[model samples]
Target: MTVSRVTLLLGLLLPLSAHAAEFDGAALGAVWALPFAGMLLSIALWPLIAPHVWHMHYGKITAVWALAFLLPFAGRFGLATAGAGVVHALLAEYLPFIILLTALYTVAGGIVIRGNLHGSPRTNTTLLAIGTALASVMGTTGASMLMIRPLLRANDNRRHRTHVVVFFIFLVSNVGGSLTPLGDPPLFLGFLQGVGFFWTAEHLWAKTVFMSVALLAIFYAIDRYWYAKEDLLPVDPTPDTPAFGVDGRGNIALMLAISGCVLMSGLWQPGIAWDVFGTKVALPQLARDLALLAIAGASLQFTPRALHAANQFSWAPLKEVAKLFLGIFATIIPVIAMLRAGADGPFAAVVDLVTSPTGEPLPAMYFWATGVLSAFLDNAPTYLVFFNLAGGDAQHLMTALAPVLVGISAGSVFMGAMTYIGNAPNLMVATIALNAGVKMPAFFGYLAWSCAVLLPLFAVVTWVWMR
Candidate 1:
């Protein structure tokens, strides 16, 4: 929002766009994907291998990758083409995505849940369930920010509680957000791309419910086993208060207002759009973005400072997301164009993998392809790639090819639990746990837990639903 920040955003993002030039993916080779590949690899590997360096210089690291793509792209295609792509990605995709997230984070961070409950197996399960349901409403980032501290406080007395945080990531951070755009970034990208606001809830609710219930049951059983092990601290770190309640409850109404803005944008298009660098910025989208910023400002103005202190609220997570995704949205421009090219593009093998020999689409393969990629890469752009690959027609995807959309949506949202880097909140929750003195697992250790638990369940989902 500051001038320097705007300059930095434009400086990094300027390489991705081309003025009025629709990129032909069939003309591009696989080498164009390296910057994107490097960006993702840095995100996945850096924190694990060099935590201090990553923490200190992640913005510089992202800038390096963005330049890596943009410099070459400008030289090869001319500056105008590169410039247009940057504006398009920024105004069309990045601004809206980051604005909504900022609003959600700001508003949710204002609401502070007070007091703590004992972390019994039943109590922990109930808390996870509540957080899971809230994920679809407040967003994984917002819901995770609101709920994790209370959950951690509840289990501060339990000596063996790493599994508690792990299951929280599985349910509240990933799987539970499948039913709505507010629940996850991938679904939100789908919404911005003309997918109906309610389409995901209608199609993916069954899967969401099935996954939520099963994960809750599994969490209860595991938590009970851990509870029975008699791992208890002699003195509870956080004593239970006589009263339990919420502060800054007014944000609840603001959250609904935010949801209304999104829903209205989808339903009430005025067909008036301004052409900015060849991208059509519609009036509805413009109004929605402005309203979100205003709502975020209102939260900051009215929410009490005491509530913020109680929540341990900070803007670091939101800032990190904005910076990292700046590089991601920039470098991903070509990969998306190539995927859009289908069989004629360099990623023809990808096309073949998701389609059958007879040219029939296979939802099971789509599920696995999107899931596997999402598990390693950032799920939002990964969702965009596959959504575009599936013909980039929201109406058609929601109707005739509904099963394929289901596969892509479920995979991106659900299997993000497969790794810490798969979704933003997974790492945020881990960091919060670590700060609270819970010895959260290293990246691979968490991966082992997810594979043991979620992969098998996903296999069953494929057989019963996707197939």
Candidate 2:
């Protein structure tokens, strides 16, 4: 993590000046991906097998996998390639990703919703709809953190509510983020890769609206069935207030600033750049990241202390994200590289799966493949891999390859609901729900819910849209 350590690792592990970009993924075998696989396995199995060890040393576990990949990588392919990759992952990819998330998390957590209404099936579904709409504005994490406690408060009296939280993940955490880059990490990555700021909203609007409307409708029917089964024994724990409204509204300005900064970075092209190690830091992007940090700081100063208290805002969730993603970003570098290498790389079979024999992009295959991998792996980089495989040209993807891009976008965002680990926000929402006294399902148990409800809806989506 230290500069000197990085210097030594890069200097000795790989050839001097050799960057990951110079490393030919085609020359590397599937064995190079073991560390990434190990990292995924660590995230998936550790918590289930040893809760104490995983909880305490998850960072260390992730670090081990990262080192596993880095040390061997340096030894095999020197600076000519891997150096570019290592620097890019850190400076360009990981740093910006984490910063934006932190900024959104900090500001959104300050805006708490107060005075919850009773949790009727209609009310719950309506709240889901609103949160889904809000996700594009606030980012999924912001909206989820803001609305989740009120949702918990509303449903505290209900005998059965896990189903409500499950649908919340489907709609708010995943599908809701489809319209904008700020809404989800994957889309934001596309923004960084030169996609237009509103490109996702432009091309993905239909699918986003479709999924949001359909999911809301399904949630309503299901919640009605579950609500009918609840008895009168459980009393609502939330203290009734005169009316429903929101507090910490000042954060709205900060949220808009966040969105504006993203848009400006895309629109204002100053073509200037800085060389930091092997990564090319563009002037506009640098300015945008600085502005984001300033906005987060301003939000902290401007928002009242009472708002943070009301929200019960804490740094624990963000810290958890920081620790886990360090390992993820590091280990995933090669996987992304190899994936970008296309049919010549170790994942050739995977490449072949999403392509027709005549070499056309199968939008449906792209959807399922991207979605399923994203369900288990980190959705953001998984999206990048497929994005590159489909040709990493933002202009081309947005125009000529629009359908393929849609399939990729819908898959990465929508199927993140399939598992708690699919998207970062899914687990956070589940955790907040649990802390608020909801008996959330176990890992696999939650997957059952997704398989039963969300998958069928996704099938419908693929049929109507992707096909």
Candidate 3:
């Protein structure tokens, strides 16, 4: 693929400019506030207008939302050129990482669930366990997509199977994704912003343990309930079964190749070796990224089409992801740009609110606010805003702030289960489930499940660990 010079130049320039000079803290804070305000306005008004003005279909509604969000980017671009003398000046470096994370998770998800079409009772339980583990590595989206199809297939003979997928979304797609940066976009953003990769892993262990236990417990109970309900229904002991087919387990190699590519792309950063558009740039981190891409490209040649056939390799899932996330990319650009321009002033009050009573440090409030906003707005930008705030001080406040940061990370990834729009994977799972004839609950209905189930567990997390 021919790389766009424009894109390459912009990539080289933006980071240089961001690092070369700092903007007014007040301006940056004000800009950051716009998105938060917009998020509130969007969520508040979406309900009233969603029923009457927008189509109920997920694709169409999400498309409209994307367009609405993009308008601000155009304005920001013009404003930045005129006044700030910069173009695409927001903290946009994380966008590619976001895309990489989304794609990696999607592919990983597809791999985990490929084999268990028409899962038996034993298979369903196994899939849940496997899917949960996959959630920590490939991400909730990756695990959810990989497992959702087989899960639906397992319950194909039953009538009360919709709830199975709902809880599946809650477990594998959202809450389970909280354990690592690989599990959620917000934390990945943290990594790019100088937050160490192992920091979240180390700090969030308690929250992860708490939530994982809670989700597993809930899933087991629900699975049992549904299992009993299945027993009451007439059994199709002799139902027609699809032919058992096997191919080279080469897809596992392919999956690993893809994952390496994604991880490298995610961790790659521009360095000072490259120069473009009057700026010097460095990107030594691209080595790992290039290697991963090379592996993926090679897999296309080395892996036979027959393996993909068994996996039911259709482009539809990736296509849907591309289409929707493109809209997301377009819409949030301006929102984030504006936030970057003026985050310090408007968000200062929010920062104060997040501080400890003695004006020392408070991580708990930081986690709660960041996590809550992450549920609606893209978590990447939310992470950036908080990171910038936290990094501003040269002093080591990690001990004080670490718990809060972990809280934020966990909350963002876990609570993404609250709505279809909460995280990319949540919607993907819903789409796949619906496509397979399982009707997911409405937005508010899903929120009710999260509140009743996830919130209590989160409280436990706060008390036991974050406090």
Candidate 4:
């Protein structure tokens, strides 16, 4: 949207900001979730059924769905409450979320791995393993952006290389990110809620290893089968070089700085906070955001243009994410409020699924419940929902209810591979592959791949571990 429209919308909403109050979830009906469902459905179906329209007018479409909720919400509740909800979503959630993503995207895009190796089955397995290792260090977004071009270039000569990208999403984009907050948004949300920095890595390392090695093994077998068909191009599109090295190495330091900023926010608490439309804006968070913005600027200013060109980096994907997630965050306010209400609210059935007859939490049920929703909804907020449902006490969760937290974390991070829309980087990787002439599967086709390969493994995980 244009700046003028944004200004006007803020103008309308800010008048009652001082009177902002939280939504009463018990009072909200299921109908209030329509806009959230509509937004998700539009994201899923619109692209498949009407690619042209969706591509051209997704921003406008997102705006419509957002307004569909906002207008009705204003009429049902008072204008003050609606305005506060928007303010909270924007200030507390959306801004920090988008800024961090943009910073990661910019920094990672700058680091280009030049030249290529032949995409042998061994070589492919090794690359996937390296990416899986890096996912926790540099973030799934950063690692995916940095690794995808090299992987694509390596396989450009092969005819049946789409499976390579699919497995990349399964391993590097999702499961590999299970080990740290920087690796995935959901884990970061956990960090923001007081989960320790190394907590996920400590708790989830074994699970991550199991999933990553298993997927890599499966990929190797499948890739060898495809490789045996020997459908090679007479001449490779991207000829292999004697040695490959990386450009834009400075972004590595910037990434570390970004990591430091994130860690600082989690560790440094000055006991100072400001209330903006009923949202708590902490000093550390503000400082971290400003530092992140500066880091992104530094990356753009210092990185050479040729590196970005070679990477084929564009802001289009980030812009699409920013717009679509704005609608998602806006429409999801009531849904989250309802979920937060537990048994008294509209999502009582969802609450029941994770709760035992004796009112105890069920780790196995938490695993499936969080995973299934995460596959279809935004995994970050899905993580938050289950986190809250499991009693949003981070210290208690880390110690007494550690198993339940494990289920929630693993589900949010790993099951994101189940669909293109499940995680931000899943679609981003698919788009990159498609642009490089890899014929990626449609949304449902990818779903088939994930379910066939992933469900059995997840079942094993539940039986042996979570249960």
* Whole-model Cα lDDT of every candidate shown, in order: 0.91, 0.84, 0.57, 0.89
Please, what are the lDDT tens digits per residue for candidate 4 over residues 246-337? 88999999999998998898889999999876779999989999999999999999999999998888999889988898888889889888
Deviation in Å, model 3, residue 461 alpha carbon: 0.4
Candidate 3 TM-score versus the reference: 0.76
Better of 2 and 4 by lDDT: 4
Give the poorly placed runs of model 3, Cα more than 4 Å off. 1-22, 28-95, 102-123, 231-248, 258-272, 275-281, 299-344, 392-400
Identify the candidate with maximal TM-score: 1
lDDT of 3 at 388: 57
TM-scores of the candidates in the order shown:
0.97, 0.94, 0.76, 0.96
The lDDT of model 2 is 0.84
Report clash pairs, candidate 4: none
Number of backbone collisions per candidate = 8, 18, 26, 0
Model 3 C-alpha lDDT per residue in residues 94-120, reported as the tens digit of each score? 334535554464344234333335444
Candidate 1 clashes: the total is 8
Q: Report the C-alpha displacement of residue 465, candidate 1, in angstroms.
A: 1.0
The C-alpha RMSD in Å for every predicted model, in order, reads 2.1, 2.3, 5.4, 1.7
Which has the higher TM-score value, candidate number 2 or candidate number 4? 4
